[model samples]
Target: MRITLERSNLLKSLNHVHRVVERRNTIPILSNVLLRAEGASLAMKATDLDLEITEATPAMVEQAGATTVPAHLLYEIVRKLPDGAEVLLATTPDGATMTVASGRSKFSLQCLSEADFPDLTAGNFTHSFKLKASALKMLIDRTQFAISTEETRYYLNGIFLHTIESAGALKLRAVATDGHRLARADVEAPSGSEGMPGIIIPRKTVGELQKLVDNPELIVTVEVSDAKIRLTIGEIVMTSKLIDGTFPDYQRVIPQANDKEMRVDCQSFAQAVDRVSTISSERGRAVKLALNEGHLTLTVNNPDSGSATEEVAVGYDNDPMEIGFNAKYLLDITAQLSGDDAIFLLADAGSPTLVRDTAGDDALYVLMPMRV
Candidate 1:
């Protein structure tokens, strides 16, 4: 294919597609990015069997052709070229090699048959909706930290996305957990989003999609089916197979009877937990929380090492209660709070606790207590 494009534009498109290409591939074509030059546009596609990304950029196509080249190598070559340089890509008659040139630099990259590239079949999606990029990113960022890395319970390895009717309004909800803690976030359901099927989007796909949502002005179109899910943003599209396992009933784990509430400054509480965790290096990062009337004390003790205790004034008027929790878990939950104040609801030392932002009730987090 003979195509001319600005160096920066090509590099930007490559960066988006390259995320799906694996570093080491058992199949030769899997290491290459498929380039197709057609009517004033160039399409770059890459996949790793599980996820696929396709990006199109405006280019001057002199000859209509297609070929595959090393994804990383091509990306590096274009990246190192001088800014504002024009890139020329052409393929020989036999299509055995691809020639790339920019100013004084030129190189020939080995090519693979475009026919060998895996094709992702479009699934029959009955439901589709549009979401603001910022809203979707917030849903993923707030709950992704709780996704399980353990492969044994495969259902817990992704974010569970579904629709729920709460307070007489439909809401889009995302939930994730790894047994120790659970995170849940909700937003107003978009137009035409009714009756959408619940799907478990795998962790890796969620991470890759998150990078593409940086542009707040862009709106993403999402299509979901029983077997596959597709997300389209601007000129880029991503398709992936959905996890087959059923996610556990997360609602059961959320505490409904926790009445003892404590409100603390989010940043201060996180910093205190981080400081105390340093003392207990061998005890799995445990920190004790002792709460009293209008005062909260954080303490960490390691028999072999020293102990640390810090007290912060809070907005709690409940009876004195002492609870032990892993400092890391506490920080993870607090990091998701969107406001300066974090509200914690505790039933007792032995019951699970619920946390929420003081500014709104759109998001809620629950953490199971740990013995110190």
Candidate 2:
């Protein structure tokens, strides 16, 4: 195989494909990326058995053929090439080595048989839809932070994606939780998204999907089945196996009757939490919230360290109350709020507290209070 392409184009395609290639591989073929140069395009594919990504870029194909080479090594070579330099790749007659050249520099890499690359099985999708890039980005950004890192509860290690009826309107929702905190967000379900099975998209897939939707101008075509998910954006196709675990009913955890309500500037509250938490070094990093009419005080106490307290003006008219929560959890939820004020609906000192953005109802967060 022989192809010529601009350095920048080849580097971008490599960066996209190499995310799935594991640095240390037990299998030899998995460490290499399959390169197919045919017609006017070069297709680069990489996989780690569970996740796979393919990116195609237009290139000047002199001799059309296919080969596999070290994914990261090739990427590094292309990245270090001078700007605007043209890269040339050619396979030796024996088909065991690939020669890469640009400017006055050249290198040879061992090539593996392309026929040995594993194919990702993406069966007939039960549901298909087209969604705006921005909408998909919002759905992921609002919930992914709360995904559980614990492997024992594998279901909670991913974002739960499903379609639900909200106020008689069909909405696509993403929910994630780790037992201590939860995040839920919804958007109008795209056409043809009906009857889609709820699926748990694993944490790695969510991170890789974010790269494909970073461009807001593109519309992503999503196909989902009980076992797999496929996302196509332009010349890039990403496929991953869904986690085969049951997600707990997150709806039951959200409180609907919390009466004590408080509204505070989101930025002010986040800053106060950050400042006060500096004093505590506990695993939970618990911070106590003291609330009264028109005022809120955030305090942190650590016997080994020190104590800190910060007062932030708020719009609280409820009875005096004190609630304790993990400082990092509070920061994560508040970072999702883009508006000026964040509304908190409290039940008491022991029950979970509900939080939302004052500007919109599309997203909600629940934090299980800790005992101070």
Models 1 onward score TM values of 0.98, 0.99
Cα RMSD, model 2: 0.8
Model 2 lDDT, residue 170, Cα: 98
- Judging by TM-score against the true structure, name the best candidate: 2
Pick by lDDT: which candidate is best? 2
Q: What is the per-residue lDDT of model 1 for residues 47-94, given as tens digits with 9 covering 90 to 100? A: 988899999999999999999999999998998999999999999899
Q: Write the per-residue lDDT of candidate 2 for residues 35-144, one digit (tens) a residue.
A: 99999999999999889999999899999999999999999999899999999999999999999999999999999999998999888998999999999999999999
Which residue pairs in candidate 1 collide? Answer: none
State in Å the error of residue 34, model 1: 0.6
Every candidate's CA RMSD: 1.1, 0.8
Summing lDDT over every window of 10 consecutive residues in candidate 2, give the lowest-scoring window.
275-284
